[model samples]
Target: MIIHVVAIIMELLKLINTFFESALFKKLINRKRSLNYIQFQRADHFLITLSKTCKQ
Candidate 1:
């Protein structure tokens, strides 16, 4: 009985692991990272423009 319970738990863990490593999950992560990068770039550009305008 103990062995059977352990085997079931192991199978559940494997399923969860595969889900995390799936392509859909990877796409979601990449999308989030790109969004953050775009936001950072926009903020940086705004600051640069603001500084240039101030100097002028």
Candidate 2:
């Protein structure tokens, strides 16, 4: 029946949406981690420079 076909299509769409949502969530998490790492490296570099200047 048409109703069954429509129901199946809706389920497929829901599954696809769930998959994309998880994928996007993972990408966002990775981006945040990379950003944090970059910030940490910059802070470390600044501290090293500050120490060298103080020593000089």
Candidate 3:
């Protein structure tokens, strides 16, 4: 009876681990996309600064 309980617990742990990993992966991807967006915005701001300086 103890062995059976242990087996069930192990299976539950495995399922939980898989769920966490998938969620983590999705979060990382979203983070990377946001970083890219930030970088693009920064580049645009830099270009605007340069253009204004050149016109002055």
Candidate 4:
């Protein structure tokens, strides 16, 4: 019984490792690339706010 449990655990670990090695996992790791537009908008808004504060 213990051996079977260990085998199952190892299989699960292998599957998780394979998932992390896939392209989807790499895309997830590069998630910041997908947020460039959002980041740019946030930066523009911040600059606008700063300019407004400075003017006041």
Candidate 5:
């Protein structure tokens, strides 16, 4: 009976760990995507500025 209880507890812990890790991974991915988007926008602005300067 004790062994069964321990096994169940271990399974529950594993499931909880998995859930947390998935959530953390999704958060990281979203952060990375946002960073990339900002960087791209900055690059686009820089290119526009360079083109305008060249035109002058």
Candidate 6:
């Protein structure tokens, strides 16, 4: 029973490691980075627009 439990734990760990190494995981990370970048870009644009409107 203990050996079976250990085997299961190792399998789970391997699965988790593979998931981390997968392209899907990398895409998820990159997606977050891009989202952050887009948010910053949007904020910069909004600030610039606000300043222009205020000046006008």
Of the candidates shown, which would achieve the greatest lDDT relative to the real structure? 6
Per-residue lDDT of model 5, residues 1-56, tens digit only: 96686567556656754764697756865778777657755865775575466446
Estimate, for each residue in 2-46, the C-alpha lDDT of model 1 and write its tens digit.
668656755665675577579986786687877765775686577
- Which candidate would rank higher by lDDT, 4 or 6? 6
Candidate 4 at 11: error in angstroms?
0.4
Q: Which lDDT value does model 2 have at 47?
A: 55
Off by over 4 Å in 5: 1-32
Which whole-number lDDT from 0 to 100 does residue 1 have in model 1?
90
Per-candidate Cα lDDT values, in order, are 0.66, 0.63, 0.63, 0.65, 0.63, 0.67
- Off-target runs (Cα >4 Å) in candidate 3 are 24-56
TM-score of each: 0.48, 0.42, 0.42, 0.53, 0.42, 0.49
Pairs with backbone N, CA or C atoms under 3 Å apart (clashes), candidate 3: none
Q: Which pairs in model 1 have colliding backbones? A: none
Candidate no. 3 TM-score: 0.42
**For model 6, where is the 10-residue window of minimal lDDT?**
47-56
Q: Per-residue CA lDDT of candidate 3, range 17-49, in tens?
A: 466469775686577877765775586577557
Candidate 6 residue-wise lDDT at 35:
75
Q: Tens digit of lDDT per residue, candidate 4, span 1-56?
A: 96686567556656765885799967866876567746755765775575466446
The residue pairs found clashing in candidate 5 are none
Q: Give candidate 6 regions above 4 Å deviation.
A: 33-56
Could you tell me the lDDT of residue 24 within candidate 6? 91
Off by over 4 Å in 2: 1-32
